[model samples]
Target: MRTKVSKGKMAKLLSVVDRTWRAAGFKIVQARPKLPSLSAAAPDGCIVKFSVGGFGQVRFDAGVGAISPGRGFHVEGEEGDTFPKAPNGGPDYTPDVQDRYWSK
Candidate 1:
């Protein structure tokens, strides 16, 4: 079974993604909370979109190539917790998929 990510957690994740993309040199075209999409434009004028998948997974789409999550992308509990929480709010058993994407 899959669990949905909470709104607060989703916001945090999106913020992280925004920072990561900016650090990777992508310009943020727009990032609106009301909208379900976060759009960024590449240096070459290509627009990339990041959206929340129906199952609460992070999805990435780049016009040129396939994008996948990079290293160190995992969701953990509140700041004080030392371990990640499962979507079911139990022990984390979910496989780690790339949550952040960067161009090489």
Candidate 2:
């Protein structure tokens, strides 16, 4: 048997996979778009965007790229995946957008 999926579905699916891998001590490092503010206008249907140090950068809905190679296996998160919800209405999705910066 075989099954088909839509572009939206595929995007969501890929997000899930990336989330799962990150949870398992693996990092999906990718560069994501910068947001001016939480209350600012976001792209249409855009859930989140971020950048990974080693995996490069990517925008889930707008751009495309390869999944960053990590020290673990390949995985992603489903729609119902358990992730911390940021308070003050940060983003309307799981896996909060975060980044690591170092400066002297």
Candidate 3:
């Protein structure tokens, strides 16, 4: 599911995520620098490997799609997570896409 995060606060949020991941010794790399598929992504979310505690090193995607600059961006942690199975036979993940909307 995606959340609408104001563009003004986007930088702050990205900074926090960057610092947190970097502090964890994770290097963020991009796949296609040019025509990036994941808008406002930390490099290529495809190569980001995150430590999921006992779950071992689970690769995660940290890119926001469907970007509305100055509005909000979408973030897809992973396909499964991004589109998690729904409960009570309801729809899957909210938005079914990872994106962030500008709250402001």
Candidate 4:
């Protein structure tokens, strides 16, 4: 889900996610998704999910200044343990479609 993060704050937000994911040498790739028919997203930019060197996958959704749990425990890790979230919450990221075409 996306939490109205300003374009300026994108970097700061990434920094938070990057800290945890980067430590594990993982790359964050953005995807513009069109799945489940009406679920077209690219909605204010969101970090959906990524592979963990074959261990499993971790799901994510970007918030203003925090990251709330997407699921109790997704493919790899729990979303809450993975990010610092804002007191307010936001929308869920797009459906998990592996056909990722990378974006900055």
Candidate 5:
């Protein structure tokens, strides 16, 4: 899908995402606007895709999506995959806990 936001705005959004994730101690390999496919049946929407090294990729819809101010954006990750288990044997979603585990 084409993004409602301009290219400059999208770049700023991705920069903020990269900075925020890095500040929280997560390694971001790449974060950018995904290119549209050449096939005739390809979806018409655009997505901001990001990859966390050794973990997985995440896609965020570019239309009407905001990266800040109360979690306005939508994100989707790969299915049937799991992040590193937490210390209490649950999923590790917190930045502090994830940093600890990923640091090892």
Candidate 6:
């Protein structure tokens, strides 16, 4: 998926996601553009993909006004297969955009 956000913006967002998620105690594994038919919402914007041990894979959709506002942060795919039970017992669809520095 091609995003309208610039590469610089994407890089910055990735750094922020890496730092934030790492600070959250999750091992910052890796990040990618799209998970390839994984996300429930195909948001072609700034997305941060990562793998936290025991949590499988996760993606953060940064609502940087690309395409639509954004899908915030969420995880699709089967739990234990593609992802695990989300943190805070939250649903797969989480509004993490409000919980990050990007909200500023």
Among these predictions, the greatest TM-score belongs to 1
RMSD of 3: 15.6
lDDT of 2 by residue, 1-104 (tens): 01222333434435554565456444434522232111111233223333222222222333333445656464466344343445775533432344232110
Tens-place lDDT digits, model 4, residues 6-104: 334344444555556556554445422211111112334433442221212223433332356564445655444223343466533423323222212
Top lDDT prediction, candidate number: 1
lDDT of 4 at 52: 21
Regions more than 4 Å wrong, model 1: 1-4, 53-57, 65-104
Judging by TM-score, tell me the better candidate of 3 and 5.
3
Question: For model 4, what is the alpha-carbon lDDT of residue 103?
Answer: 17
In candidate 3, how many clashes are counted? Answer: 14
Candidate 1: 10-residue stretch with minimal lDDT = 95-104
* Candidate order, TM-score descending: 1, 3, 6, 5, 4, 2
Tell me the spans in candidate 5 whose CA falls farther than 4 Å from its real position: 1-3, 31-104
Pairs in clash, predicted candidate 6: none
- 14-71 per-residue lDDT for model 6 (tens digits): 5565667556555533445442211221133334343221222234343234455768
lDDT of 5 by residue, 1-99 (tens): 112333334445456666665565554434334431111111323333342222222234233335457844445663645556789999764323222
Q: Count the clashes in each prediction.
A: 1, 17, 14, 8, 3, 0
TM-score against truth, every candidate: 0.49, 0.25, 0.34, 0.26, 0.29, 0.29
Candidate 1 lDDT by residue in tens digits, 23-70 = 988999988765456889878667788787654555667785434566
**C-alpha local distance difference test of each model:** 0.64, 0.34, 0.41, 0.36, 0.39, 0.38
